[model samples]
Target chain A: MKRIILSGYIFLFISFVISAQGFKVKAGGNQTFYFEDKGGRNQATFFSTTPLEDINGTANGIGGSVTFDVANFAKSLKGTITIQVASMNSGIELRNRHLQSPNWLDAAKYPEISFQIKSVTELKQIADNRLGFKILGDFTLHGVTKEVTADADVTYLDESEQTQKRAPGDLLGVRAKFSINLSEYGVDNAVIGNKVSEKIEVGVNLVGSNKK
Target chain B: MNRNQKKILTAVVIIIAISFIVWIIFGGEIFTKTQVLVEKKDELFPDMITKEWRNKFIWGLDLTGMVSFLSVIIGGFFYFRLRDKKHK
Candidate 1:
């Protein structure tokens, strides 16, 4: 009876060690990291600079999931990042209304702006768990879909006592930046050049966890 | 170009100027904004979250455009009324 109890304890210890191995970029196969941050830490920002006004808009409603394969980080990466159109705030009530109106993004008609990651390129190992790469994705905005390449830096954080304070599982910190032309996206507003820039610079900063 | 008309026009200018000066003194915003985004940093994350706070409206006194328009309309009414009185 004592021998059986000792064997059971050994099995439990091995199970804990196997489960706590954490994420290794070169060791694991595929892990789906979810970007739905309940802490409201995920944010996307847009900046339009013109001679008349410099508009800075921010959106906090960002949610998505990305499946990252360690064996093939380039081809096996797939995910969609979405931003709610109505969640965009430009600090001005009138401008915010105009931005969501039919003349601009038409938040009522197309309520979401999303990016579907198609491929990854220029992958460079910044650290043992950090990578710098360019994510080529289909960017859908204002009911128009276009291919855009975003420069991205991603870091993998293993689940530890310190990291568990922020999330329950392994975390992925992704910072990406990209630019878009309003004309190409069918946004032909007359205020594009005078008040708002034709090309808008966009940025996204978020942390995702591989809990599920 | 009479004395009363000149006085009324001067008053209009003063009203517009005072409105503009007060607006500048308070917020100086070219366009009125309802809310302002204040950034807050996280303990471990490098990115920041923005908190929305209510911005003071100054009871429409902060709007230079609206105040200027109303002043011009009221000032014009008084100026034309005085002009017609002189003609009568």
Candidate 2:
């Protein structure tokens, strides 16, 4: 009886350690577009908010992976995402139609946007609860891929508090921010003219449930 | 009132209501400020790009546009059905 109890405790401890270290990718994020000239003014702007929907040309879900290396100072992430060109919403039906045409996203030819992270730098911890880091990656859009860097904030929620609220353990909240250029990806079209700004911003918040 | 006349009036009313709603939702003066911002950006930096601001603006507009689109579609369908009944 004594040996059995000891083994059970060891097993429980191993399980807890495994559960504490993991990664998950969140899909309900937004990618926005902005156009401005040299003067720091904003020009035409729009966003693809529902990028995970089938109507938006994606595969009905967002695809990405999260990895946690508790022993190491840094974690890693990489995955491909599909954004339906037709899902681009700009308030006006006419404008949306224009965006889906050959001039913009060209949903038919380039139906998805994919990203692959090449490196990650773990920065100093912020506020004890939040971890700061920078991710260097390559994003592909409209058939053109470019290297970019994004800021990330990762937070770990106390297990006892999370359990009291009945929240999933894996979903310790995560937030990431980054920016991109449309012109660099060759998404320029006639309706937007040359007046469209090349820069765009992207943000992601992921709540992942542990698979184990 | 005759069924046909009743249907026609209903259709007209619905159409007007929908147009009003669209005007209220999409025709607001917010775009004016957006236009101004774009113009300023173009004139000042010309080469610099502010992706963060643009993305946030685009994301909000996208959400609003989607909601409005759904509302319009539902409203338009009712109007069309009422109009078809009147024509018959």
Which of the numbered candidates is closest to the native, going by highest DockQ?
1
**Chain B TM-score of predicted candidate 2 relative to the true chain B:** 0.36
Point to the candidate with the largest TM-score.
1
RMSD of each: 10.7, 18.4
Against the true two-chain complex, what DockQ does each candidate achieve? Answer: 0.25, 0.02
Q: What does candidate 1 score on TM?
A: 0.75
Q: Which candidate leads in lDDT?
A: 1
Q: What is the TM-score of chain A alone in each candidate?
A: 0.84, 0.60
For model 2, the docking class works out as: incorrect
TM-score to native of every candidate shown: 0.75, 0.48
lDDT of 2 by residue, A49-77 (tens): 22322111111123344454433335434
